[model samples]
Target: MNEVGVIDWGIVGAGHIAHRFAQGLAHVRDARLARVWSRRTESVAAFVQRHGGEGCGSFDDLLASDIDAVYIATLNDSHAGYARAALAAGKHVLCEKPATLNAGELRAVLETARVSRRLFMEAMKPPFFPLYRTLCEHLRRDPIGPVGLVRAGCSVANVPAEHPSFSLDTGGGALLDIGVYEMFLAVDWLGAPLDVQTFGRIGASGVDTFASVHSRHEAGIAQLFCGLDLDGKGDALLAGPHGYVWIHEKWWNPVRATVSYAGGRVVELNVPFEGGGLNYETAHFCELIRAGELESPIMTHEKSLRMISMLDAARSALGLVFPGE
Candidate 1:
């Protein structure tokens, strides 16, 4: 509601992603945390006290506050519900990714946003970063010629089942938790694949511990894998008829990439981020809110839905299902 200044915002969760979102907001001069809310009263109180934010009694109370936007950092299952509530209450929403478990849930959230005439964005975070922007530009310029093949994977090891990250009920798994990032980056950069094949290891709890998926497109093909059982590395390589461009540490935060072209000519590109690389998205959200845009053209509702659809297909192929899916 504050015109000519930073937008007032309420943070809906006080978890790790909430912390990072708050930290990222710090880099933006035109956004202010108006309130903080969490079911855990003590946690919300602590977060408010540390960040100098007012403590709202409940998430509903936070929505009732005179805030322009609500950042939903809750669990995967709670994303749609929270976003729906916020949109209905006439507040813009920027939720952390997989924004919803499946395409249907995502569509429901987007429809709510449409009816309420409020903005809704998935906080995929990495795509809005400087590194991705640079990559997009380079690829558009055909810096590496036509891409031939791309190999992308995201993996981590030794995650305990007790952690909420491993919980199948709230939509936890290797592919959903981390693989989505790889899939998003691949599809975002290369467009939808003509066909996709998946293979992976599922845990006893009915969660995917490891997954390998091959995506074939008209231009080229991408091979993607993700898992928790084995300690693996995540990287994205855009190979062309002549050579390839390698994105180092691709999935989460890509800071550097090496481009190798014909005659073995190699060039290393570095993404020098000013802040946490989160500022780019934070700034983008603020800009969209100011402009009264309901969805980002780059990360549109359709894009989010399509990506989740792919995830659902992969899960189905793996015969993996969360508790109530």
Candidate 2:
């Protein structure tokens, strides 16, 4: 907390996604950008200039500051290390998705947060979206009549070979990058799976270029597809005996949705939001911090752990392993 009763945030990693998160800070009234750190001084300087924050000489300097929370947006492999350091420094953490490379790493960081008594949450923006909230409410009312299947995909074409997204050492793969969103939707809708099966096309770099996962849950089934080497329709569909709901393209950051019943009636919803859609999560984080909460109700630590565990299983089935793992 700051002098003005707002949460002061220190951002780690000044990448493109980090800049978008800074843009989201503009839409949050209870949070202020306070400090930023990155391995490259030039990137940190640019981020500070564009986002109105002080540039830290190193990540240690940022953690040593009086910031209320640290937002980890670095490469997937470094999430646990930075989050552990921040928690040890008595700062809350909002790390980007795939909180760590595997469930084991996630457990370690979460244990540290428990001991430090600091709030820590994975930065999953969609769960806080108004569109998703409305969808959840409708589902709770049983309008869909027991959802039996969920199909989701997020795929992009032709990522350059040199991109970090294709490096095994960096924890690069379709599963960690975009597949996590699909997994989140599945788990949020159907709970953890009883069984998970996965198949993938591994690249020369040992990272997956394309992947498909199927999970069986008590409620029904979830099928997710993600790829860095192909284009996809980019939508998610939940279906039941009586009706179905369709989240629009880019389902992860959906702006529109439709619900259709067996009786030929359909309802469409358009969700309007501000500033890159990350503002929703930023605002929610501030609310939880102010309320003395350790995790988000919408995206709880348990949910994150389950998601990572599923990912770990999927990786094992697909025979995909990071360099150090």
Return the number of clashes found in candidate 2. 0
Best by TM-score: 2
Compared with the true structure, what per-residue lDDT tens digits does model 2 show for residues 1-325?
Answer: 7676699999999998899999999999878999999999999988888989899998889988999999999999999999999999999999999899999899999999999999999999998988888887867764878888999998899788888889899999999998999888888878877899998888888888899999997688999999999988899999989999999998888889999999998989888777999989989998988899987888999889878988898889889988777
For model 2 the TM-score comes to 0.97
Could you list the CA RMSD of all candidates, in the order they appear? Answer: 1.6, 1.1
lDDT of each: 0.82, 0.90
Clashes of 1: 2
Q: Which candidate is the best by lDDT?
A: 2
Q: Which stretches of candidate 2 lie over 4 Å from their true place?
A: none
lDDT of 1 by residue, 165-266 (tens): 677888988877888887776677567767778998778776888889887765667788888888887778778777788888754687898888878888
Candidate 2, position 215, lDDT: 96
